[model samples]
Target: MTGGLEWAVTTDGQAVTLRQVAAQAGVSRQTVSNVLNAPERVDPATRLKVRAAIESLGYQPSRTARSLATRQAGLIGYCLARHPGRSLFTDPFLHALTEAIEATGRRLLVFTAPEGAEGLATYADLIAQRAVDAFILSDTVDGDPRHGWLASRGVPFASFGRTWPEQGEQPGRWVDVDGAGACAELVRGLHSAGHDRIAFLGWRDPVPVGAAKDRQRGWRDECRRLGLPEQAAYADSDSMEGAAHAAATLLDAAQPPTAIVAAGDLLAVGVISEVRRRELRPGHDIWVTGFDDSLLATSVEGGLTTVRQPAAEITATLVRLLDAGPGRSGVLLDGRIVSRSSAPLDL
Candidate 1:
C-alpha cells in the first residue's frame, strides 16, 4: 500500500473503476452493485467474484455515495410533537425507541411541533423542505391531523399512537399503547378487591384523545359492568401540587371511595401523599393504583399497585415499526401489574 496522503497506485498506475473490476473478475458492474446492495439476489459465483474485487481494490462505498447511486437517502427521521418538555418523551421510553430506530441502521432527527395551526405550519415546512425521509410520530392523538397531512404529501410516517388506523389511507403503520385495555384491567382488579365505589381522577381540561380518553372510557365501561356508579374527579391545575390538592378534595368527600384510579403515576403519588396525610394507609385503608410505574413508585413509603409500561418493550417496538415501514407489523405488550402492600384481599 502507498504511504499516508498518497493514492494506492497499481503497477499500471491507472485509476480503477467498476469496469476495470468487472473485467478483472470476468463479471459485470451491475453484478457488483447487486452484491453491494441486495447480495442475496446476486448469484453465489458472482458474489464471490465481486467480494474478491472489493478486497483487492480496497473499494469502500459510503452510505451517501450509495444513496446518490440509488437515489435514496437510506435515512429516516423520527419526530415528537412539541409539547412542554419535548425532551421528556425521549428521556427513556422514547430514548429507547430512538436506539431501536438506530439499531435498524437508520438515522434519527427528533424535534417537536407547536400546538394549534402553528403545529401544522411547522409540519408543512418540514415536508416542503423534505427534512426527513420518514417520521415516527410520538405523542399521537385520536384522528391525528398529522397522519392525514402526511398521507396527503405521500411521505411515509409511523406513529406510536394508533388514532385513525382503521380509517387512514396508510392504516398499517401505527403502534400505540392500549390505554383502554389498561383501564379495563384496573377495573377488573378493583372489582376483584370488593370495591364497588370506584372513582376516576383525570385531568379536567381536554386531554389527548388517545389514551387519555380511552382510560375514561374503560373506567366508565367497567363501572357500568360492575353496576357501580361512575364517580369522576378532575383537577384544573396542571401541577403535581394541584393534583395532590384535587386528590385531597376527592378523598374528603361525604362518602370517600373505596378505591381511586389516577391517569398518571405522578397523580397517583400525589393521591398517596394526601392519603398518608389523611391518616389512612395506602395499601390498606384505601387500595391505590397508578399507571406508568415510574421510579417514584418504589421510593414511596408504601408500595403502590401500578401498571408497568416498560420502556424497553416500547422502544423495541418503535424500532421494529420504523424499520419495517409500509407494512403492518406491531405487538401490544402486556402491562405489568405490580402488586404491593396495598390492594388487600376483599376480606
Candidate 2:
C-alpha cells in the first residue's frame, strides 16, 4: 500500500484502480491518467480503448488520487434550483446541456440551493470541498449575486446565460442564445402579415432574468420601430396555467392583439389555449410564436412557431471558454425561427 504500486484492485471487489484499468486497456498507468485528465492529448483510438476499458471495469477514480496528481478535481459544477420545479432533468434544454458536457468525459457535480444567502453558502461549501475544477452557471438573472461571489473567490466559472455589464467590468465568459434578435424576427414577420396589435407574454418576476429581458427588449424595440401597438403581459410563473391567465388578459383587453409572441414555449402554449377556447384559429385569426422551441411546441394541435435554441452548440462553446480560462467575451448563438401552423409563414 505504501510502495509506488500506483494502483491495485481491492480483494473486496469494491472498486477498480488505475493499474487494473491500464491492464485492461493495454495502456500504462501514466497513459490512463492522461486519458482521464487531458484526454485531448491522448490519441483518439487509445482514448477510446481506455474509456471502453474503464466502463467495462466499472472504474471510478479516487478524488484524492486525482487531486494529488493534477491538483484539480476532474469535475464541473452546475446549479439546478433556479429552474421551475428545480428539476433540471425534466427540461430538455438543461438535459441536453448536461449530456453534452458529460459527453466530453467530465463528470457533473450538481447542487440544489435556494436563492440568496442559502445559495451562496451552498456554493461556498462546494468550493471548500474542492468538488469541481470550474462551474457552469445557468438561469442567470440581473444583479445575480452568484457572479460577484464566484468572481471574488477567483473561481473558474462560466455562465450558460449572459451576465449584465454592471455585474462585472466586462460580461464574463458565457454562452447564450440571441433571444432578443430572434424575438424581433418573430415580431417582424407577424407585423408583415398585417397583424397590427402583437402581445408579448413573459415572466412577471421582479428580478429580471438576462435572457428574458433580452427577449422582451427585442419584441418591444421591433414593435416600436414598426409603428405597431405593443401589448406586453407577464406571468408570475412559466407554467402553462400561469401563461393562460396572462394570455387571457391580453385576449379580453379592450383592443385585443391579433398576434402573440411569448418569451418561452410555455407562455406560447397558453396563448394557443386561449385562442382555441375562443374558437379562434391559430396562424390565421391570431398568429402565435414562442422561444426555446420546447417539446410542447410540436405537441400542440398546430405546431407552435418558435425559436430553436442550439443547446449542443451553446454547451460546446461554454466548455471551450471554461477550458481556456477567464476574460473571454460572451457568446451569442442565433436561434433559428421554426415556422409552423401556429404562426403564419406568408411574408
Candidate 3:
C-alpha cells in the first residue's frame, strides 16, 4: 500500500487512473466513480467487476477528492478541557478515544476552548470552517450550553457523558458509565467481605449533577439496603487535600467506618495517606476503594481497589452513535470493580 492506500502502476510504469479502470471493467467513468464513492448505488455484479478492475489495476481512490465531493472533512473534533495539574497525554480515556478514532480512518482534531461563551464560539468557528465532520464531547455537565448550541444547529456530535435532565430534549447521542451501579457494586462487594460500616468520599458539586450525584446515590442505596449507616457519606472538592480532610472527619466520628469508598482515585490516595499516617495498614485496618481505575490507582504503593470505567467500550459506542447520525438514544454502560491490596475482596 502507498500512503495507506492501494496504488498500482501500469506496465509502462505510469500511475493508474479511474478512466483506465473503467475501460478495463467495461463501464462508464461515472459508473466507476459511483462504485468508488457510492457502491450501494451500483448493481452488485457491476460493483464486483469494478472491484476486480480496481484490484487488478491497483487503482487507489483519492481521499481528498472523495472528501471534497462529500463535503466531509474526515476529522472528529475534541475539545481538551484544561485541568490545572493534569497532562492530556496521561489521560487513559483520551488515549483510548484517540486510538478508536484513528482506527476508523479519521483523524482527531484536538483543540482548546476556554469555558463558557468562548468555548461555544470556538465550536461555532470550527463548524463554519468545516474543520471537522463531527465532535466527541467529554466533561459534560448539567445544562451544558454546548449541547443546546450544537443540537440547535443540527451539528453531528456525541458525548462521553449523559445529557443531564436540565439540558432538556437536546438532540444528540451520549455514552456514559453507570456510576451509581458501579458504586453500588463496590458497596455490595465490600459488604460481602464483612464490612458494614462504609463511608463514601465524593466531590461536592453545588448542583449535585452528573457523575458526582450518580456515584453517591449508589453508595447510599446500597448502604440502606444492607442496613448499614448511610450517614457516613461526605462530600468535598475533588482534591487530595479535600479528600484527606473528609477522610479525617469520617475516621474521627463516633463509630467510624471501617471502609471508605472514594469517588475518584485521587481521593482514594488521600484516604490511604491518612490510613498510613495513623500507622494503620490499609486493607487490614481500614479498607479503601476508588473510582476511575486511573494510573494513580495502579501506581499507589500497595495498589488501589477501584472501579474500571470501560474506556474502550465507551469510545466504541460513541463511534457507533456518531456513525448512526443524531437523535439516537443515549447509552449507559456498567463499570467493574478492580480489587487490590488496599481493599482485598478475599478478606
Candidate 4:
C-alpha cells in the first residue's frame, strides 16, 4: 500500500486508474463504477473484491467527479432547535441517534436554528446551497411547519418523532419511540411492586401534540386503570435542579406519593436528590423511575431504573424512511424498562 489515494503509485511508480482496478479485480469497468456509486446494487462478493483491489492499488475515486455523475452529496442534515440557555449536547438521545447516523457512512451536517419562523429561512438556505441530500427532524410537534415547508420544497427528510394527530395529513417520513406506552409499562411494573401512590413529574408545557404530553397521558391513564392515587407535577425544565424542586413539592404534599416516575432521566435525578435531602431512601422509602436510560441513570451512585428507548433502532429506521422518501407510513418502536437500584426489578 503506497498510502494517500491521491498520491498513490503502482509497483512501477505509475498512477492507478479505474480500468486498472477493474482489470485487477477481474470485473467489468461498469462493475467498478457501480461499486463506487451504488454499492448496494452490486453483488456483495463483487463489491468486496473491487474494494480490496482499490485498497491494494490505493485508488481513490474523485469525489467531485462522482458527485457530478451521481448528483448525490451523500450527506444527511440535522437541525437543532436552539434554546435560550440549553445546549444540544445535554440530550443523550440525540447523541445516540447521531452515532447511528454516523455508522451509515453518510456525512452528517448539523445546523442550529432558532425556534419558530426564523427556522424557515435556515431551511431554505440549506436547500438552496445544496448542502445536504436529506434532513432529520426530531422533537416533532403538532402542526410542525417544518414538515409542511420541506414538503412544499420537495426536500427529502425524516423525523425521529411522529407528527402530531393534526398533522396526520402532512407528507413526510417519521419514526418515534412509543413514549406513552413506555410510561404505562413503568406504571404496571411499579404497581406489581406494591406501589399505590404514584406521582408523575413532567415538563410544564405539555403541548397536546408533543412527546412529553404523550408520556404524561400514559402515566395518567395507567394510574386511573390501576385504581391508584394519581398526582401530577410539572418542572420548569428537564434539569436536575428543576426536577429536584418539583420532587420536593410532591413529597411535601399532604398525601405524598410513595413512588415517582419522571418523564426523563435528568428530572428523575432531581427527584432522587430531593428524596436524599429529605432523608428518604430511594428505591426503599420512595421508588423513583425515569424515561430515557441516559448516562446519568447509570453513572450516579445508585443506578436509576428507567425506560430505554431504542435510539440506534430509531436512527436506522429514520434513515430508511428518508431514503424511501415521503408517502411511506411512519414507524413507532417500543421502549423497554431498564431495572436498576432506584426502582424495583422483579417485574
Candidate 5:
C-alpha cells in the first residue's frame, strides 16, 4: 500500500471513473473533482488522499469533458503573420513564446491570416467556434485595429509588442522589448570606442511606427545628445539586398560615418557585405552593429555585435499578463547589447 491506499489494477480494459477514485479514497465525487481542478480549496490531507486514489485507480480526466464543464478550451490562439519569403519557424522569439505558453499547461493554436480586414475576421471566427480561451498578439503596429476589436468584444488577449497610443487611449496588455533604449545603448558603446561619425540604417515603414521607428529614434536622440551629426541616417527595406544598396550610398558619400548601426542583423550583414566588397575590414575600417542577436549575427566571421532581446522573459511576462486578464498595464523590458569583435565595448 502507498500513501495508505492499496493500488488497484483496472480490469477488463475499463477506464477508471472519478466515482471509482472517490470510493477508493473514501471521499465524495465532488471532493475528488476539487482535488483535480481546484486543489487550493481542499485540505492537504484530503488532497493527498484523492491524489493517491487517482494514481491507484489510474484515472485520466477527459479534456473534452473538462472544457465543457469549465468553459475554457485550454488553448491560446496566435495568428501567424503571412509575410512573403519569411517563415515564422526561423524566429527564435516565436520558439521561446511557444515553449513558455506550453509551460503554463496551455497549448498554442497557430493560424495564418493575412493582414487587414481578413485577419480580424479570422479572430472573430476563432471566437465564434470556441476554439481558444485567449490570444497572444505579435508584430503590433501603430493604429492597429486588432487590439480594439478584441477589447471592444470583451475578449482576453495579451500582445508581444506594444499596442501604440494611436490605437486608442487605453491600449490592451502587452510586453515589448525597448527597441529605442537598445539602440541608444548601442550608440553609447560605439561612442565609447572613440567613433564619433555614426550612421543608422533602419527599415522604411510607410508610416513612422513600430520597432524600426523606435530604434531610429534612439539613434537620433543619442547622437543629438552627444552632439554627433545625425545626417547619416537612412531608411530602406529590411532585406539584405536593400540594406547593401543603402550601405553603398552611405559609404560613397563625401563624409561617410566611421560606424554604422543597422536596425536588424540582416541589415548589418548587408553593411558588412558592402564594407568587405570595398576592400574594407569590418572592425578595422568601420564599426558595425545590429539588433536581434539572431543566428546571422553569430554566424558572421567575427561575430557581429548586436542587441539581444530578452525572449524568455518577454514570453513569461506575456503569459503572466494573459493570466491576469485584460486591462492590465503593459510591460516594456530592456534588451542587452552582446559585445563582439565587430564593435567591442568595455562592458
Candidate 6:
C-alpha cells in the first residue's frame, strides 16, 4: 500500500490548525479570522501572509468549530415523530411550519423516531450527536422535559403546536396556539347552535401529553365553564381510525351527544364521516368541529368548521426566538374559529 503511491500529505510535518497557521503567518488567530471573514479589516500585507500560511499548511477549518464561533449552523433540526398512519404530510399546520422554518436561511434536519422509541430518547440522541445547532420540536408535550434539558445544556429549541412550561427566567423560546381556548370556542359555537350535549373527542394519553392533551384539558375547562353534559366526553388515539371507532362508541352511548369538538382535524373528519355513515346529517344530526385546519378540516366539499391558528405568526415568533439566541423562552399564540358546514356558524 505504501509503495503504490505516496499521495498521503503528512500532517506530521505540517500545521493544519488555525493556531498553527496563525503562528506560522506571524499573526494572531483573530487576524487570520479577520482575513477570512473581513479581509478589509486586515492590512493587505498581513492578509497576504495569512493566506500564504493557510495555503502552505493546507488548513481546513472544522465545520463544527466554525459554527461554534459564528453561532449559526445554516441548518435547523426538526424532530418528526408520530405513530404510523398519521397524516403528517397532509397536515397544513406542519407544512406551514416547514415552509416558515425554511424561509429563515436555515435548512430543516428532520429526525424521526426509530422503531419502538419512547420517552426522551429523541432529545438525548439529537443532543448527543450535535448534528444541529437548534431543534424544532413539533407537537411537543406539556411540561416537556426536553425543553428543560435543552435549557440546561444551552441548546436552542422551539415548539410548533404544543407548549412547554414557563421558564420563569427566559420567556419566549417556544411557540404554541391556545389549545384550551380553541376547544372552549368550539364548544361555545356548538352550544349556541341548539346543541346542548357537546362532547370532546381526543386521545386520552399519548406517549407524551401532546397538544391533544391540551385540547382535552380545554374540553374539561369549557365543560365546567359552560355546564355542558360531561359524561359524553371521549378520547381516541389522535388518529382517524381511532377517532372513527371512538365516534361509533359515542353514538352507542346511552345518551349520544349532538355535537362533537375534536382535538385534531383528522378526528373531526372521522366523526363527520361517521355521522354520514349513520345517515345522520353532519350539521343537523351531529355538528362536528376540528382544530389545525388540516386537509381533514377543509378537505370536505363544504369544508369542516375549525379553529385556525396562524402558522406564520407562531413560526415567526419561534424563529425569532431561535435566531435571537434564546433571549426569550415561551409564547402563547391565539386561535380563531372559522365558520363552515361541519359546525354551525353561531360565532
Which lDDT tens digits does candidate 5 get at residues 100-122?
88777678999888786668989
Least well predicted 10-residue stretch by lDDT in candidate 6: 1-10
Q: For each candidate, give its TM-score against the true structure.
A: 0.75, 0.80, 0.80, 0.81, 0.82, 0.69
Per-residue lDDT for 1-347 in model 3, tens only? 22223333464577887778889999997888777655657899999999999888877676786677678898999998656343212377788998888767687999999876568989988999999999998877776788768878989899888756553464588888999998998899889998999998877657334777778889999999999997554546666777888899999888998999998888889889988998989998999999888888889887999988888999999888888866857788989888999999752
Estimate the overall C-alpha local distance difference test score of candidate 4. Answer: 0.80
Clashing pairs in 2: none
Of the two candidates 2 and 5, the one with more favorable lDDT, higher being better, is 5
Worst 10 residues of 1 by lDDT: 1-10
Model 1 lDDT per residue over 1-347, tens place: 11111223353565656666667778877776666555667778888988798678766455565456555565556556455542223366666776676555556776666754457776676666655677777676556677667766667777776664353443546666666677778878888878887788777776644566767787888889888878777766545676678877778888888788877666777778788888898877777777777676676775667777767777776666655746555456666667766554332
Model 1 CA lDDT for position 275: 81
lDDT digits (tens) for residues 284-315 of candidate 2: 88899988777778899869898888877888
> Measured by TM-score, how close is model 1 to the native structure?
0.75
lDDT of each: 0.67, 0.79, 0.82, 0.80, 0.80, 0.70
lDDT-best of 1 and 2? 2
For candidate 4, the TM-score is 0.81
How far does residue 320 in candidate 4 sit from its true spot (Å)? 0.9
Pairwise TM-score winner, candidates 3 and 5: 5
RMSD of 3: 7.0
Residues 151-269 of candidate 4: C-alpha lDDT, one tens digit per residue: 77789998877667664675787788898899998888888888889899988874323787889889999999999888988888768898999998899999999999998888888
RMSD of every candidate to native, in Å, equals 7.7, 5.1, 7.0, 5.5, 6.1, 10.0
Superposed model 4: Cα runs more than 4 Å off: 1-15, 19-60, 84-105, 165-167, 206-209
Candidate 2 wrongly placed segments (more than 4 Å): 1-63, 86-90, 165-171
Q: What lDDT does candidate 3 reach at residue 13?
A: 75
Order the candidates by TM-score, highest first: 5, 4, 2, 3, 1, 6
Top candidate, metric TM-score? 5
Collision pairs in model 6: 171-329, 171-330, 172-328, 172-329, 172-330, 173-329, 173-330, 202-236
Alpha-carbon shift of residue 46 in model 1 (angstroms): 28
